[model samples]
Each structure stands twice: as C-alpha cells, then as structure tokens.
Target: MTSQRAPLEPLVPHPRAPVVPQASIIPPPPLPPPAPASGPAPPHVFGLEKSHLLKEALEKAGPVPSGREDVKRLLKLHKDRFRNDLQWILFCAELPSLIQEGPQCGLVALWMASTLLVPPDGVPLDRLLQVALERGYTAQGEMFSVADMGKLAQEVLGCHTELLCGGLGGPNRDYILQHIIAGHPLLVPYDEDFNHEPCQRRGHKAHWAVSAGVLLGVVAVPSLGYAEDPELAGLFHPVPSTPYQPPPLPEEGFSGAIYLLSKQGKSWHYQLWEYGQVQESNLQLTDFAPSRAMDGRAYVVPAGGVRSGLCGQALLLRQHDTSH
Candidate 1:
C-alpha cells in the first residue's frame, strides 16, 4: 500500500473563503432602516384651465325645457303624415320662449334639447326653420325686417335645396344657413349696411357662420364606417336598445373650428372644417393619408388649387389655382 500510494495533493482554498464553524446554518436577518409614513396623494392636473372655467359656467346654467309633453300630445292628435310638420311648428314656437333667458344659457339648452328630440331622419328643414324662427324671435321680443326674414328663408330653403341637389352633409348645410343668417341684416334694410362688408362687422354674424361651417364639417364626413360601397347605406348600424342607455346626442359639442384638406382624385381635392378651425385630413376616412404633423393648433395643407389653412379669424379655403 505504501509503494502504490501517490504523493498527497495540497489542500488549497479560495482567498476569500468564509471561515465556517461547526454550527447550524441559520440565515442572516434583514435590516430595518426606516418605515414609510402615509399621507394624502397629490391632486390631479388638467391642461386646459379656460375649458374648465367654461364647463363650470355651463354647469351653473340651468336646463331648457323642450315641451316634451306638448309634443307628445300634438303627435297623438295628428296623423303620422302630419306629425313631422306639426312637430316642427311646435318646436319653432317654443324656441323663442326657450331662448328668452339669454344665448349662453337659453340658446345652448334649446339647441341641445332640439337636437335630441329630432332624429337624423325626423323633420324636413323647411318645417324646422319655420318653427325655429317663430319661437326664436318671439323669445327675443323683436320682429325681423322683411329683408332679414327673406334672408333667413333663403338660408333654410337653400340648405334644403343643396341637400336634395348636391347631397351636402351637416357642415355644408349649416355653412349655407349661417351665411344666409349673417348676410341678412334687419328684416328691412339697415342704415348701417353690415351685410355690405361681413368681415368688418362687429356683430357675431361672421362668428356664427364660421362656427356653423365647423360643426357641419364634423358631422358630415362619412367616417366610422367599414362599408365597401361608396354609398353610406350600411355604414352605421343602430345601437342596441338598453334601459340603462340615454338618448343619442352629438358626442363632440361645438368646441371651436378644425380645418382639414386632403387630395382626392388626380386633380380634385376636398376640404373640411370642424370645431373652430379647418381640418387638414380626414384621418377617419379610409382613403385619407395624413402628411402634416399635429401641433396644438389646427392642421391645413394645399388641396387642388386651394390654399387651405386656419388664420384664427376663420378657416380659409381659398382658391389658389387661377388656371381654370
């Protein structure tokens, strides 16, 4: 055994080896330096202070009555054929009384209520205007001049005509209406002749026109649909009826204007306005391709021959191509 045995190997250990004693291997305890004290969390911040103020102001304003009971009774009294016409008359008659409170309070409620009462396919524009004027002016306690009244008539009629003829949507319809309302001064001719120069006028005629244009554009664009056919017949399906659901209302209220312009065909183009400015692209549309980056302000671009953009004053869609 002594002759066969090799030289014994040296027992070398690591330089940083732990010196273990013959004892139980218990784990070390965790260090407790500090405890977190509980307190109230920080307040949430919103970017738009002015918008908050506006919302607060609107909330302070009370509700506007739509004479729903009267409308229901009227509907019951009339046949289905005459219901639409009668409803318009009733609505118009009530508008003045509704708005007598003031534009900020009364007008807002009246508009919202009216919108809710009438479905997209409800009443005709002619009847709607007739009722609106009768109610709206009566509340104001003033008679529009013949010229002004004619202008209003033309505005309403023209919008209807366009819808029938050109198939214009809400924005186009509203734009035409606003222009008529603003263009027509007193029922008779006014000595000031504000209609001669609409841009220079101090009144809200121009503002209303611009605002209307914006709103109409927002509602009109055939977005949010997946139909293969260009005709928007099967675009929007009816929402399922539910007891918990409230009536349909315009999702985006009249904020400000948004302007949008984008290419259409090889030479054609389309322009859209919403909120308070012009929208440069219908991002909602399938064919649209957005080129401009979105800043805090509205977006605009050249389309066809139009130099389209928002100039704060209004969303301008000027014809730049003089070739035609």
Candidate 2:
C-alpha cells in the first residue's frame, strides 16, 4: 500500500506589510497611544490658556547663618521658616498652619486658602474631601487629582485660580517669585521627596502645600507640615528646636558664604550668596569647578541635593474679590 504526500507552498507577505530584505529593515508596529495616565488631567484639559516665555529668575542666595541651632539653616536654604514665623503667620492671613495625617496635603492646602476670605473662613477638611468626592478627584479616598484640587480651591475657597506646572520637579523660578511676592497665596501640587528631610529618608509622594509668602529670600511655606507635625509621633522629621546662635559682631568675624552653582553647558557658574541675597559672580575657580569643589571646607550642596515640591506645580489662590 502507498500513501500520497502534500506539496510545499510558496510564502507570501501580508497585504498590510511589505516584504523587506532583512528583519532589521522591517519597521515595528506603532505603539498604542499611551493609556490615559492614572492621575489628574492637565490644566489645559480644564480650559486654561498657555504661553511660552522666560522664567529664569531665582532667589538671591545668601548665607543662611551657619549653626546647628535651627532646622532652616540645615537645608542649604538661605532663609526659611519652620513653623512659627510671624511673617509666615501673617502671610497665611492669620490662619494657623495645617498638618496632614497620612496623605492629605491637598485638603490641608485648600483649607488654608479658605482663610483669605472676609470674616476668615474655617473650611473643614471634610468639606474639601467632599468636594474631592464630587469632582472625582480622589480614588479610594486618598490619592487626588491635582486639576480637581485646583478646581476645589476655586470652588470651595471662592478665589480665582490660575494653574501652572514645570513637569520636572523644579518650576520656573520666576513664577514662584512672582506669585509669592505679589501676595497671591499659591496652592502648589508637588511631590514630597521623603529624603529631602532626614528622618523620612526614602520615597516620594504626590503632595500639596501652601506657599504663604517669601520668608528671607526663600519661599515661605505655611501649610502641610512634615517635620513639625506632632501627630506623626516621630514617624516624620521632628521640628528642630535647638538653640540657634545670633549673628556675630564685626569683631566675631564673617560667618561664611553661600554659593549657588548652576550648570551651564559643560561648566558651572558660581553665584555668590552675600548679605542674605544672591548676586551674580564672575568667580572663575578654573581648577576647582563645582563637580570637584566639595571638600568640607564649605558646606557643599549638590544640585541633586536640593528640590522643592511647591515650586513644581502651582495653583495660585488670588484673594477673593470683595468688590463683587
């Protein structure tokens, strides 16, 4: 008995894909449009105009007064207030600073903004959460939509809101300086670098804060406490309460200087921090660039060592219009 076998057939290319001589020459399939990201929609999605311009102004650097005395002096910041600066208190419209338990920075920021109204509001955190609920801002009652948070400020606090974002954690310095100096309290949506402070040393979280005003060249932050929150019970950074030394007299000698080394092309430009202000310096340490400058003679802070959650994204909370 004998069996018949089938004949071989020629290969053909699919009509959609043309044959290429080599697999390497063939193009890969187009990637699916990135799935709508899990977080809040951008400001443009909520109908805000956009523009392009220069925003490079930075704070005038100054010696933050070297001492183991205060926590503000530790962060390479020329000046900042931890909890109870009179200026920050006034800037917060006489409202108390807020602290979040767990992850409620956004709600705390909104509550602070509410105080700008006449008779001084006391918008409860629960109300803000309710707003978040109605706006679909939160998923599972924790994470929130930054866009909706902006809307929450406007809707709940009754203020005109203008949103801005830097994408990268660092914002346009001018935007921070301009809005803060102009007395517009900004509700900034940011990521808390847990490692920015000593105790929490690890990850980052999507958070928010109130930039109450500018305190001594640095942006004054009044709300959303980290180091100062007692409720956390040492789970977070503790408030620095050691005695800080007062400024030295002329005979006591100059304390030292703060230098801001900004990267320019392949080299770094040195900006001198003088008398509590940043001044442009033509300082040419040809042999000692910032990359090689850190040797403990001066307290050295690298570019990566500094970050600000507030400046990255802002929702400016303009004072409520009394005329209307």
Candidate 2 ranges beyond 4 A from true positions: 1-94, 117-119, 140-143, 167-172, 193-203, 216-312, 320-324
What overall lDDT, based on C-alpha atoms, would model 1 receive against the true structure? 0.22
Q: What is residue 187's positional error in candidate 2, in angstroms?
A: 1.8
TM-score of 1: 0.17
Model 1, residue 292: C-alpha shift (Å): 11
Residue 198, model 2, lDDT? 10
Tens-digit lDDT track of model 2 for 7-65: 21122211111111212111112222433778853211100111111111111322222
Q: Worst lDDT window (10 residues) for model 1?
A: 184-193
lDDT of 1 at 164: 14
Local accuracy of candidate 1 as per-residue lDDT tens digits, 1-324: 011111211222212211122222222122223334567431111111324553354345433222333333323453242312111111011221111111122122222222222422222322433443343321221111111222223333232111111112244334433332222111111111132211322221111121111111123323332122132221121122322211122333433222211111111111122322221111111111122122122211212111111111111111122111
Worst 10 residues of 2 by lDDT: 45-54
Candidate 1 wrong stretches, greater than 4 Å: 1-50, 64-298, 302-324
